[model samples]
Target: MARQRVPEGPPPAPAVQKVSVRYAKRGRLRFSSTRDFQRALERAVRRAGVPMAFSAGFHPHPRISYANAAPTGAASEAEYFQLQLTQQCDLDALRAALDESLPQDMAVLRVVEAAPGALADLLQASVWQLDFEGVTLETITDAVATFMDRAELLVTRMTKSGVREFDVRQAVLASDVVLVRAGDADGRDLVRWTMTIQHTTPAVRPIDVMTGLTELTGLQVPRSPLMTRLAQGILEAGGRVSDPFDA
Candidate 1:
């Protein structure tokens, strides 16, 4: 009988498990600059005393990374952070720990097992809701009117590389006007007429939309104007929405 080698066991699985935390920063925290928010989360995890898996080196740091942070002064409902862990902790415990260290406005909604993929690799597009306070819905509605009717919403942009023409109208996946109530923020009225816009990879920024509108309306944004991400739908290679985090 030929001696059979029971395959020397499967190769050791990757030593790391990545967990993605889906959170939201609201109220005053919305105004937190991206860097500041990162500090806040890091501090919270430390205080929560959760075992943070770190990289190997003389100066090891917790393997925590923030996904594309929200632009300054913009609020967000859908934000993400990836945490590396040596041993899996109860999601409830991790959430509670994070919550305790976080400020009232910053919150941890849920911790989902991250897919065996890179966050950056999975990102395809982002959808945003922009509410213009002290402005009429018609203003945004009209912009949408112009955007929808025109063949292209052309705007010039200056990049680190050089100036380039971006056709935002072509990239827009969705646009609409909606009313927003106050309580979402500080107990203050937040009714603003605003348009929703979605852009895909190699996408157009919101500032471009503002620039195009200003050409006609001459109104400044967020003079109490608030914008937030409604959701970020990840389009997979198969032309389908993929929730890599196993929500």
Candidate 2:
């Protein structure tokens, strides 16, 4: 057949801009899993009448992307979600709407237009807080210091795929492990601390660190781990710290 010429078509229009909502759940709500949080938010936003942007093709769902999925039974003060909308809306409106619909434990902190290509694009580090009881602050701090000072802190993780060896010290950026008086709970002082951690493959959870600490001490760590992701730094084009949002 003779060679036939084909016409080129113009590039597709840019996708609609969206906003990333930074929220948190503490106290009882903190125990909710990431999936639960997603569902709760979808309902709340739906009731708020936020024009949800659906995905193209089959099985369309609201274009809501959570920055990092928090593990179940963990608590977070800095959970984030990106909500794509059909049209732009007021930040205050979205915030207020979510506030009214959301539970008391979960609250929206800030609503701002997401940066171009910033959705899960820039992930630097995370700040986590762990709480426990009958644990000395000095011992915990010392252990954390040891863990941070190490050149390589390796640990084993048993995933469904299989067990794997990983270095935790590499992922730790800045951590402030302290034993704070977490107020009175049944007439007993509770131990709490905040840990600034870096995220990497085979993500290291606060619970994992706590478990390691327990293993190191062999003192039977009390008060199961309650993790809260305090902040997620920005990851630039080169994985460098660009314009980071300190949450």
Cα lDDT tens digits, model 2, 144-198, are: 7766667776789898779978777666666665546743665444566776667
lDDT of 1 at 196: 39
Could you tell me the lDDT of residue 40 within candidate 2? 87
TM-score of each: 0.77, 0.80
Locate the minimum summed-lDDT window of 10 residues in model 2: 238-247
* Candidates' C-alpha lDDT: 0.67, 0.70
Task: Give the lDDT of residue 168 in candidate 2.
Answer: 70
- lDDT for 77 in candidate 1 is 74
232 in model 2: Cα distance from truth in Å?
1.9
Number of the top-ranking candidate, with lDDT as the measure: 2
Task: List, residue by residue over 1-247, the lDDT tens digit for candidate 1.
Answer: 9996543434323335667887888877778898898888778878888777765545557778777667777777778888887677888888888977899988888887787667756555566666665545555567667666766767888877688777777665555566565344544334443333444443576767667667645655446456676555476443344454652
How well does candidate 2 score on lDDT at residue 203? Answer: 85
